[model samples]
Target: MSRPHILAVAKLVPLLLDQLHTAYVVHDRVHEASPEEFAKVASNIRAIVGGGESKVTRALMNQLLALELISIMGVGYAGVDVAAAVERDVPVTHTPGVLNDEVADLAIGLMLSIARRIPQADQYVRAGRWGKEGAMPLTRKVSGARLGIVGLGRIGQAIAKRAEAFGMSIAYTARSAKPDLTHTYYPTATALAEQVDFLIVITPGGAETRHLINAEVLAALGSKGYLINVARGSVVDEAALVEALKDGVIAGAALDVFEKEPHPSEALWTMDNVVLTPHIASATWQTRQAMADLAAGNLHAHFAGEKLLSPVPECN
Candidate 1:
């Protein structure tokens, strides 16, 4: 039998690509194909593989007449138009649990980076400023501080568990209170921010959560508090965050993701109180490989007439 033709929206890890090559004829990238070439093979494309940020727009999916699935290599799939996929009876799968620990680890890392001024201290030492200018200024303590988690989902819970090791008091704000959770619950983000020394954002990204952490939340966090975002960038208002950091509305912020990726706001780049990473919370080798395995397994399962390993909940 002929191999299924699949479109690769973004180049995946070599290991996953090797596995995919064994069962499918993979096209390199959608945009790379010539107009006539794409049209010729569009109807035969059975699936698409992408990272969390890949765009599987309605226009693109409409071209794939036989598109059976979209396999996302990471936990976040906000880039994929889930509504469009559901309308066409196509299911979407994402590697969720595999990267939870890595993301959570980064969340805690960001919290420490901000509160303790690790990045700034390192830069100070590297520049020989420590030798010339005496001791760096003291920074806030991380241990035993109040921690407010903005979204207590899987990754959020993981962050909470890690925070416990530091003896931090934990509180949370979610869409609705979780019955099993014993931590203090706040109905609103502003309410949660008001009482915590650190407010970590580990929420999912979507229209509902866009700018959920805005000026009001930042103001509530106060000048003594810090913000850590290991979740989607859109979940926090970048403009508000910049203003807060500049105006001392909040003490500092450490962010793994940004509203504009690979192009975070220029204002944040020079700010000493802010730390920025290029959306690499789940960039560790082990976690990325596990995520790749799960994503590939989901695609393989779909083609083999078996249950998908990790279909996004919305698909169900």
Candidate 2:
């Protein structure tokens, strides 16, 4: 049997599949297989898919479908047109299990950083501002803080596990309650935010959640709450957030994701109370490699007539 053709669209994490001797299929390029290129390896082409959702759209998707399966590697297949793929009878897969611990670690880190003003303090001391300052709002105690989790998925559970070490009281708002968890459940997000010293968003991104953490929610937390988002940037209102941080509507925020990709509002740049990082909550080397391997495992299973390892049944 001939080798199954695979195209790695995700630019950040390279495919580490040892089972297949593969070549790179750069999606940004206009042609991975042109007339001359196709003529050389036309018969060898089988499957093609990009890393991010938009990476493989109309033409690329159609070409990949004409052959065999087009497997996607990451949990967010916001790129794969599942309805279209289903209509075309193409099997789609993603890597879901690997990044949980990494994301959870980031959640805890961001929460602690925001609560303690770690990043700002670092900047102040490095810039010699501490020499003239009265008292640089030192780190806060995580031991007795109230922790609010926005989503109660696997990553949320992982974060909760980490919080146990800090001796935090956990409270969460899930669409549906998990009977197994002894953690307190609040009927509304406002209730959760109201009760916690820190609010950590672990929810998924999309329209339903767009601007979920807005002025009203921030106001509900009062001036003592800290917001940490390891989720999507769109989940919170960036403009409102800037104003909140500036006016002290909320104590502070620790963000791993932002409204704009690679660009946050300039107004948020210098706030001593805020801690902002590029969207890298799940970017650990070990975790990303595991994700890649798991994605490949799904593809390997699918072609071998085995069950798919992780499949997104429907988008929520």
Candidate 3:
């Protein structure tokens, strides 16, 4: 059998190199790359192993016409250009279902962190700022609070189940309503925002959901409510969110993902109410290894003349 050519854009920190070695996976385990190094791949490489949120731009797709396939290593495919891929007959695959628990866990944690001011309080302790001068504002409870989820996909369901354990009632708005959930289903994001004490965004990030949680929805969540976004930052408007947070339009926010990764706005930095972390919703050692293995499995399938396990839908 001819050896397959696979190019991975990012590194896999948690996955076992030995296991992947035996399976004939050629990967770049070191994620940090200089721009010049990436440019080489941008110019030469054919196939790509990228995050589900990483796009195969028009230029890259042109390059891949001569390559094998692009295997996305995560569940989110907002970065992948499905339209262009189809135009070129290039198959795209995503890591779905497996990362649900990890991402949902992050969502739930962010909800708790913002509501309880966990990150702020931790910083206070670490920086010798706790009880430095005055008493801090009392934190809120995640348990017994109402949670509204924007999208109820696999991760949303997983979050709902986790929230239930914390005594949270789950209400959500989806493309089509889910009638089975005991928790109420709202028809719109606006309605969901108005009802819940905490709003957790588990929706996909794309043109459809871009800025879905805008100033109006922020207003609907009310001054006492908190927002937790473990999804994409594009789903929330940064300027409006900073304004709302500054004025306490909503109580606080906790975010793991951002509209512009590696650099979030300077506005959010001054706000004591917001908790920000680099996008690490799927950063758990075990979970990430699973994702890589699954992505690698998808690539193996395509190269072996078999069907891809998790190909992104042609419609999406």
Q: lDDT of each structure?
A: 0.92, 0.75, 0.79
Error of 2 at 127 (Å): 2.1
Residue-level lDDT of model 2, residues 179-279, one tens digit each, is 99999998778888888989999887766788988998899887988999988888899999999999999998988888887789888888878888887
What residue pairs clash in candidate 1, if any at all? Answer: none
Against the true structure, candidate 3 has what lDDT?
0.79
Cα lDDT tens digits for candidate 3, 1-316: 5444455665544363344455543536222355455444444444667775665677656654455577788777877778887777778888888889989988888888888888788777888766575656788977888999999988999999999898887899988887677768888899999999999998998999999999999999999999989878899998899899988899998888888878999888878888888998988888888887888788778767897888887734
TM-score of 3: 0.87
How many collisions per candidate?
Answer: 0, 4, 1
Better of 1 and 3 by lDDT: 1
Identify the runs in model 1 with alpha carbons over 4 angstroms from their true place: none
Superposition TM-score, candidate 1 onto the true structure: 0.97
Per-residue error at 160 for model 1, in Å? 0.4
User: Which candidate number has the best TM-score?
Assistant: 1
Expressed as tens digits, the lDDT of each residue in 35-86 for candidate 1 is 7788888999999999988889999999898999999998889889999999
Residue 193, model 2: Cα distance from true site in angstroms: 1.5
Looking at model 2, the pairs that clash are 9-50, 9-51, 10-51, 53-79
Candidate 3: list runs displaced more than 4 Å. 10-46, 127-136
